[model samples]
Structure formats: structure tokens, C-alpha cells
Target: MVSPHVQDELRIFFTSLALGACMRETLAEWRPVVDEAIADLVPREIDTEYLESFFGEPTYAYDPDGLQRALSDPLWDLLDRGGKRWRAVLFLVFVEGFGEDPMAYLPYACIPEILHNGTIIVDDVEDGATKRRGEPALHHIYGRDVALNAGNALYFLPLKILTEDPGNLPAEQRLAAYEMLMDELNRTHLGQGMDICWHNEREVRITPAEYLEMCACKTGCLGRIVARLAAIITDQPERVERAAATYAELTAVAFQIGDDILDVENSLGRAGEFGKEFGNDVREGKKTLLVIHAIEESPPETATRLQEILEAETNTDDELAEALSIIEDAGSIEYAREHALELAADARAAVDELALDAETTDRLYTFTEFVVDRDV
Candidate 1:
């Protein structure tokens, strides 16, 4: 017989494992269809490596020598540091739910993955990020120009993948899909712009509402695009659009708050650190929701100290510690955590209105939980 504590622990672990396995299976069910669709274009001789090499193009006339060096460079290796194939997975999820052939939207699925990579490349540059997936950043290893162009090269891949002669798709469907892709592209750019603006204007003061608006522009919009594009492919554009928008808003807010929390809780080496000599956000003076709320709620002396530290040209470790103390004592961390939970709950409710098939809906539900519960 097991002790009560051990039994409870085991039960929780198994439950989590089961949920993960279900999501894995749901993603797996679509792989064959995706593979077949990709195979339709890329010969069996081609693999992910060759695709990465092709993505890193040069500015000058092709010198096979220089081209080979650039292509073979390790800087582009982030392409292989795979995740859940989430964006592609979402694309196919929507396709399957609409009772459409999974193969039909495999090409469209490539759009999100490509765009996602493009953003990461540019983001690393903007953030001056040193590491990606435990490896040197592309900008760090390849230099800014190559990194920029390589990212730019990826921008066109989605078009190449998506517009690949729609073969059997009706002209109307094909046009509709392309339009959806364009809209997502525009929305994502707007979000990226907001993120960049926030990064550059480090001293800007913002309220929680303003911070949410920035997220809607910077992070939430892309997420909205992710689900809505899936709906477009599935041809359930109207019903899924609002659901996608709502999920994107909540998830984005939670994600940013979690990021700020991690900046405080985790060590700098973990990529949670935004690269300041100390608390990056504090040092750079980026206005995050937590910082704003903490200032608002702090006692007069604590607020003055935080303001002084934020305005300092440099903050020492002691200053960083003191600032964090103020933030925590002001209850900003707990506030952010509760807000994330509330938004996540709202996002879950929004999904209930969709007429998704049982398995897909369950996978989506699991995905929402995973998003909020994520540790990294």
C-alpha cells in the first residue's frame, strides 16, 4: 500500500501525463497528412537541413563557396530545435475539425511555422539575445546583416508554400485562404511594432489597460491570427474569429506577465533574463504591467525609491534587490498571477461557443491549460 501523499502525487503525475499523451496523439493523427502534403512538393531527397540552407540566402552573386559557408553555419540551427509543431498542429487541427481533408491545408500550416521563425530571428536581434535553445543566437553568430536577411528570406517561404498551385482547391477557397494569410501578416506586424516601440522607449509610463493594449498589438494579435487562420482554412471563419481573438488576448496577457515574473524569479542565464547587467527590464526601464501596478500600489517611500532606481543610469545588485522587494511587497507578483488565471479562465469559456468536434475541442482545451500552466 502507498502512503496518502505518494498516492496523491502519483495520481497528479499520471493525470498530467495522460493529458499530454492525448495532445500528442491528437497532433500525431495529422502528421501523415502533413508529410504527404509536403512530400507533394519537396522530393524525398530533401530534408529539414536542406530547407534551412536554402532559407539563408546571400546578397551578392552566388559563390557556391561563400553560400555553402553561410548555409552550413551553425547559426541557422535553431530551425531544428523543434517544439510541438504547434502552429502547424493548430492549422491541421482546424482543418480536421471542419471535416476537410487534412492534406488540404498542410501548405497553409507552413505559414505560421515560417512566420514564427522569422519573428524569433528578428526578436533575438532586437533583444540582443545571446542564446536560443541553449545555443548562440543567430545574430550573435552570423552577424546582424546575415541574421536580418536570413529572417527576411523566411518571409517569402510561406507564400511559396501556401500558393503552391492549389491543385484541387476551388479558386474561391484558394483566394479566401490567401486573403486570410495577408490579414494575419498585417496583424502580426502591428504587434511586432508595438513590441519594438515598448523596447525602445524604455522609460515610458503605462497603466494596466495600456499594457494590455500593447500586448493586444504585440503578442496577443499573433495568437489571434494563429487560431483564426486555422478557422479560415476550416471555412468556419465567422464563429472562430471572435474565439481566436479572445483566446489571443488572454493568452498574450498571461504570457507577458509570466515573462515578467520569470525575470524576477529565474536566474539570468535561463533566457528569462532580458539581458541587462542586472534586472533587464528595470535596468532598461521597460514598462511592464507588474512594474506599473507595483508603483501604483506601493507606499510613498517605496514608490519614490522605485522611481529613483528606474531613473538611475545604472542599478547595482543591491538596487535591483531593493526594487524587487518593493514590487513584491506591493503585491504586484500576486496580482499578476491572479490576473493571468482570470484571463485564462475567460479564454477557456470563449472556446465553448465554437462547434468544434469532440477530440479537437478537447485538444484545444488542453492546449489552453498548458499555455497558462507553462513553466518556461
Candidate 2:
């Protein structure tokens, strides 16, 4: 069960989104207003004509049926599914921290969310995931071929927006931002590749340090990009921007570890609420911090058994339950929870290094706690 304080924090976050103070809602109730605003930035029609007319036809003829709908519809469907909007919110919060109007960066704020959701669509297909956010995976509904094309299209959408002058940012700064985005994308893919490779290999043992590094690249890259973008828009000093980016990276590590712990606890019934099966990480043989710690700390025989279960092609319900028992018996769950708190504290410390107002610093600290403590 969620504590009252955590519940209140979630309430405020969602309330902010609903009031259009943080996010542009795409729900049916707010669709008209939100769609109008988004249309100004992302057009309804995403046709090859724009590409051909703007950049000339490619060397090879390229076409897809219902190109516009194929590209935009799936994106809208996923976005409208609802999320915490954490990255976008963090971008705005940092903008406000720098004494600028948060609303001014709204269009650019959509960049993180678009990139994140696009990645999720692809991740689901790659991981053979059955559900996402309590609904069937995008590929499950739209089919893999169409979903892959749509996901790829969404990845480039942000770049197209950056090339434009929506933020009215200087050309040099825009170029710098584009470079930063590319850098983070490369890091994210590298981290994902490592994870995919590890899962496919047999009898592999990953150290806790390696697992943390992977999380930094896979998850931290998202946070770093938004924090860096905030610094860019605010025109802060390089040192201050680096500090903020570091804080964001630490926060991402805590967030991912917290998620790992939740997968084991399964206390919130995430399978229903988050569209992730209970213990899916174990089933996929994910090298989460908890799994690493449990294996390293367990008896030699027990460790071998744990690894064997993880490497199995499939496990019965009883086998999965026993694995959970082993992890708990090894006390890895509590260890992970305590470690997440430590990471969150470190993230808060990094925030203090930023030269923001007292109130913004306090809010950022609170947000770091929220990142780790959230139930969903």
C-alpha cells in the first residue's frame, strides 16, 4: 500500500498535468485544446511529400500505405495511454529553476516524452513484452512491422522539431542541442545492446558495478539529456550544467533500482497497473542489482540454483516463487531499498551544487525522493 505522503505527492503531480501547468494532455476531455497546441508543432499529416519536397526524393523509391496514419496514429495512441511525464516535468522544473517561464519551453519539453515513448514501443517488441501501462503492447495491436516503422519515425520527429525555430534559440545553441541529443541516443542504444546481449548469453554472471553502469547508460541518458537541455536553454555555466546532469543521472539509477525492487516485491500488483508481468525481470534473466547481490551473497549451491532458474527457457509458477524466496532469504530486497534511498540522497546532494534558488533546490530534492519512492 502507498503511504499517505507518497499518495499526496502523486496527487499533486497528476493534478499539475491535468491543469496544463506541466503537461499537454491528450485525453478525450482535453483533446481539442491539447491537439490544437500539438498540431502547431507536430502536424497531423506526416507524409513523404514533406521529405521529398523539402529534401528531394531518395535514390530509391520509398513508400508505405497510409503513411500519415501509420506514422502518427500509433504515437498518439501510446502518448494518450498516460504516464508520469517525469522527464518533461523535470525539464520544465529546471527551466523554472533558472528564472525562466516554464511554459515557454513546453514544445521542447515534448521532446523527452516523444523519445521515451518511442523507445518503449521498440523495447516491447524486442523484449517480447505482452503489456505496457496496463494495455496490450503496441506491436501486439498494430503488428511488429507497422509498430517498428512508426517507432522509428517518432525517433526522428524530435530532430525535425529541433531543426525548426520553435524555441527561437540561436542556431549555434540549436546545433549544440542536436549534438547532445545524438550523444544520448548513442549511449542509450549501447546500454540497451549490452543488456540484450547479456540476456541472450548462457551462464553469464554480471557484477553489480556492471549492472549499475548499464542502468546509467540505458536509463540515465534520458535524464541527462533533459537536464542538459534545461541548462542549454537557461544559458548556465558549463560547471552548473554538468552538476545538474550528474544529479539527473544519479536519479535515473535510483529510479531503475527502485523499479527492480518493485518487480520482486510485486506488492502493488504491477501486472495490472503497470502492464508489466510480476517477476518479468526474473523471467527475462535481467541482471538487476537485487539479483546480482543475491547471487553474490547466497551460498555456492543456492547461487548455482538461482542462476539455473534464471537461465531456464521457462519456469513454472512454483519455480518462479522459489526464486523469489531465495532472493528474499538472501535479504537482497531490503538491501536494494536501502541502496535506492542512498542514491536518492546522493542525487539531492548534486542538486545542491546547482546555483538555483532555495525553493527550486528544495523542490528538486523532493522530486528525487519521489523518483525512488513511487509505486508505479
Candidate topping TM-score: 2
Clashing pairs in 2: none
- Model 1 residue 235 CA deviation in Å: 1.4
Output the lDDT of residue 313, model 2. Answer: 88
After superposition of all CA atoms, the RMSD between model 1 and the true structure is 8.4
lDDT by residue (33-88, candidate 2, tens digit) is 33333444455665666656534577996463476557766777787677656676
Q: At residue 152, what lDDT does model 2 achieve?
A: 82
Give the per-residue lDDT digits (tens) of candidate 1, residues 259-303: 887676553333334554446777766677778888899887788
Candidate 1 clashing pairs?
A: 191-217
Clash count, predicted structure 1: 1
> Could you tell me the lDDT of residue 77 within candidate 2?
75
**Model 1 misplaced regions, further than 4 Å:** 1-19, 22-76, 165-167, 267-280
TM-score, cand. 1: 0.77
For each candidate, give its TM-score against the true structure.
0.77, 0.84
Q: What is the number of backbone collisions in each predicted candidate, taken in the order shown? A: 1, 0
Best by the lDDT measure: 2
